[model samples]
Target: MVRVTSMAMASLLSHITSLSLPLKPHLFLFSHSPKPTRTLSFSTPAISQNPDRNVPSSFNEDIGPYLSCSMPHNNRRLKVAVLLSGGVDSSVALRLLHAAGHSCTAFYLKIWFQEGFENFWSECPWEEDLNYAKAVCNQVDVPLEVVHLTDEYWENVVSYIIEQYRCGRTPNPDILCNTRIKFGVFIDAISSMEFDFVASGHYAKVVHPSGDQIHKDSALELSQDTVKDQTYFLSHLSQDQLKRLIFPLGCLSKDKVRKLAMEFDLPNKERKDSQGICFLGKIRFSDFIGRHIGEKEGVILEAETGDFLGKHRGFWFYTIGQRQGLRLPGGPWYVVEKDVKNNVVFVSRNYFSVDKRRRLFHVASLKWLQGLPPNQMSQLQCKVRHGPGFCNCTIIIEHGEDGNEDVAVVHLSEDDQGLAAGQFVAFYQGRTCLGSGVILESWDDQGFSVCAKALENARMEDKSLLGKPVKIKVKPETVATESCQLDGMVLSNQRPCKLST
Candidate 1:
């Protein structure tokens, strides 16, 4: 609905035109949207309220000293390419890099989106964002490059998003997209551009020990910004990837980044942080998903009796633990289960009622981000979603349906209601992110995925698609009548025919 004028769009285009090697236009199918310049209000938290003050920001902190102590001394400038999204965190990173005299180049990535979807997903325009990044680069005197990843984004990122939702998993496209695109595609681009390293404004850190033996092959060390830290999402990145990565904003808390952005006079000093899909702007999850996937209205049910309660807008619109928007007439109710096949969402009068205890869900497609062997993963702590505190649960890794390996179920020693199918179940050891895997299924069954207490302290395996196919039997007579090969596998009484040789 919101449109940017041609003049404004052209102004943003000038930077693109200025590149020595012209960018391929198809890479950027993104159109500009209209947004207002914001007057920001920054409220400093009370000293007691700041749980992340321990995170180091300056060159004097523990992280800085650790890095300084580790590597061979070099006076040469660190050539770092930052994935600038034109936000406060990134702006601060640029300022920090520039101040440190690092040979910093800002690469502004442009991924295409549906026209009106921008307003629905985010408030800022992609063109305006690119322009802000250019302005900062021009002011900071660092070269900025713009790369449009439209097609690759759709194929790699968007396609995965649709598939994840279709299969009933709440996939974190940002993390996957970051792993595959920003670090994957964008990093490859920088290799051609001759940059020494890549950086971003992500609120997570990577560190190495102080010694001659560079921990280039070592795991990424967790930063102190646990509240603002994004290490969980970055868990999928490998040691090889971390070898050339930098996080200038990782050491700083969100507040310090804002303060530094203000002190640096960066244009996006007060820009609000993006909340939803990586590039897609402020659109609601269900609405944005609706643009790509069909929104089929489903039945709402009572958790105990399975009685029809009411109709739901769409199952895609809700997650497992959601409680606020059920619109029920009875006393307050919570969604206890979703029957994606029956098109139903089940609710309960009391969320923690004793009856809710009997039913449990199963998890599948569990991946270890670090690709840790099955042994180390069994010992780590797991977080089912972003905001919830880490739960002390045992990890179970086993082969599952169709030759795919998955996480069967995370048995919470204590029952926590509102478990959803498509969310992440990240594993951690203390502050270090061991790795994370997509939650496949969850529920209590005999021999549920939990490792035995003696084996609970074991590690995780890194094999992909570990489940065997479910074999079904088709009517034997039909196969013979149809002249189909009788040797094919049968699952749930449905035999898949193999064509006769």
Candidate 2:
């Protein structure tokens, strides 16, 4: 309904560039790239276009099996609150639930940038999203409510994100958005309405306890679409939250959802999937951080040797395992560590060095969906980020001073370069998501803490060296590719080492 033209988009980007704080060159390049358009067309049998018409037999035959397991056991029509974004997945989800004979109310959350952040708000097409959401709800005669949770989002989610970044930790805001707002505050907001359940387009499964298993807690499982599965984001949800939530697209793949969208003839059937952190929308993350935290010039140094390499806007602008924006000659460099106190970032060519084992990490503030830790903690699958990949992990429960289970020491079967403090590690046993915990710090296999202690020592040494001016002529050194033997295999394809004097 509110179409943003290509000219308008380009103009908006130009305005961003005209701001007092210019974005990084690479970020500017990324912003200038053309956005992809979705042009899918299907010739499937026509389903009834009328909202009042009964679902076609063909529709039932196609999607019936998937819904069979998720539908109400009593076969009773229920009042459902559906979280509708203007995306195709959510639109198709609303249609599926409508066909399932449930009374549905659509809610479009107005949690975009609040006032005073008009610049960011203008960049995000939330008005278009809301318009599309309204169109989808109107198609099915479902009443749409615009919930203003901007204050709550800023207080709970946005504030936490800023604090985490300020503390030099990479936090996953999407995971918090699902846990704190979508399921947390939204549920409380509509509690007085006494809706039977809340539903969404998330690609994750929630299996409610039934029959004799009614005594057991609701289980969160992976979606049929593994690649699109969103359990990582939903991992922090409590058992109560899972019990009251419904994910219609859990059993459906992305391709199947697109087909359903065509069959339903929904207004947003051709809408492309939204990307990046939900709140930021089209705004570059660097620009967002720059606006909030601002920038301070910091020095980049080699991790093994304290040789200066280059300068960065700020240490907070980069993250571990990052290989971009370093603008240094010689070869590719990876961010290995950060000296938060000194505002310094450390890099290395041999990021995957055997000496720098990232297999072990400590996680704090555990949230178990089942109300308790899993019985089988030794053999579990864990994800450090939102993706299909899962690393086999074992948990060593650490007790607090009061003898309560306080921390979880997770040992990954393999090393993860991207492991960062404040990131959530969602654990899974088979299809069921046990829950997740925040990574406190990481360590090497030798039991040496790699993140905190190592960085602290570097920070202290740098502090002593600060304010003492010394001019030293630096010479470039050519080092051969470093190789290591792992599991009886030699890894000799490592990047050529770049040592600075």
Candidate 3:
């Protein structure tokens, strides 16, 4: 674990200025003056704590019930390979596909797990997981092929995870791993194996079976189980990848999946789900990385005044807006910032925002799924996290001052707190997903800095959609706040709307 101190206070504070937006009044309940000199102390929990040590491994069982029973395209039989993990969901999907009369095969990706991770893999060892996948093949009577992807997994996923942490960016390894390793490497292998499509247990739906490049035309819709939808972690997948992918569990709920698993009487039907990191199950993420990334104790302080609150194990382990493991004197404290180079964790109660008129926000390596016009991108909803709601935003796209051709800036309509540099900012339109980008820079003022890489990929340009009619369902607040005069009004891109103020 990393820690912070007074010397490094300026670095974090320099990035955070005050914004024009009025914050909660109780924000100033603590120190009013900025005191970067004061220091705080905190105690952190061991990083390797495992919550599911004695749980039985759900691997080594039949996996037919967790999948959808949809027949593959008849002519070709749609030779498909399902990424089986010996988990209930994947098993169910496997069973469903086999019952649908599709030529299905199971591919279990065996990656390297951290040392001593065996405690978590009890009952269902790695071999058991693989055998369970094989067991499913026996029941469905489909050929099961297990491929060893340790080398690719290490080089791609593990290396990338380490690199991201070394750079102070909290990388979502699962997303990147899926894109680069699972879908990239594994899919590539399956392609050569002559599999028509690759299937998984992801709960996301892809619309339009044909005639769409960006998939915006073949929009990716959220699954029925909004809570169980894993699309957020999957937005990084390419349109081509999505085309050959199958999500048999997209339409089913968790409860429904369990019921089906029971009906199929699969070996792991009653098996519990795997939790924690993907490959390094049950091991605390911080602990797993702590071994590789050396840790040093640092100061934890109150964001208001540099008042010493507690000590932290490592800054790299914790993220902004985290509320646990603070061990502070007050009831509870939230992490507002992490100083990686100097080592510090900034803590704050519910309210402690600077009222200055300037702030900064940044997005790095931004990729756009659709080529929406600048006007549309600016006018759409922008969400920074996985919360249900969103914020109305106005994007001011601009070139970087330093003349970095790949850099751009997007000014939000409001100043948001707990903005981190490495997180993602996804753009959406109603229930439809437009695209997303990375957080390049974050500030209290100056809006957010975004990179240009992903924006290009996210562009959606189809002339046919230009004149298509779109329904506009305004929120009650939008209608109540302004008087509607239909003489000249623009609804859902339709123009000629005049409103009386």
lDDT of 3 by residue, 248-344 (tens): 8877888988987877767788888765457665456666668778786666655655555556777776665456577665434556656565566
Q: Model 3 reaches what TM-score against the true structure? A: 0.67
After superposition, which runs of candidate 2 have C-alpha atoms over 4 Å from their true positions?
1-63, 211-213, 403-405, 442-501
lDDT of 2 by residue, 50-138 (tens): 45444434554545665765554556788999998889988888888887778987878878755677566667788899878877766
Positional deviation of 37 in candidate 3, in angstroms?
53
Model 2 clashing residue pairs (backbone): none
Query: What are the TM-scores, per candidate, against the unseen true structure?
Result: 0.69, 0.79, 0.67
In model 3, the Cα lDDT at residue 111 comes to 73
* Cα lDDT of model 1 by residue, 1-501, tens digit: 223222312233221110111021111111122223311111111112223322134334233432342222455677777788877777677767666667776777777554455344346477677777766776656656666666557756677667656655456666667766788655654454456678788776666433476643445545545556677677766666777777776556677777766766677877887665665554555666787787776656555554445667777666554565777664455555555654556565555444445233455434444455446544555555443255655655565568434444455544555455555556667666666555444455521122232121111131112133222223233211111110110101111122111
* Alpha-carbon shift of residue 348 in model 3 (angstroms): 1.0
Cα deviation of 423, candidate 2, in Å: 0.7
Best lDDT goes to which candidate?
2
Residue ranges of candidate 3 with Cα displaced over 4 Å: 1-76, 113-125, 211-217, 351-360, 370-375, 382-396, 399-418, 446-501
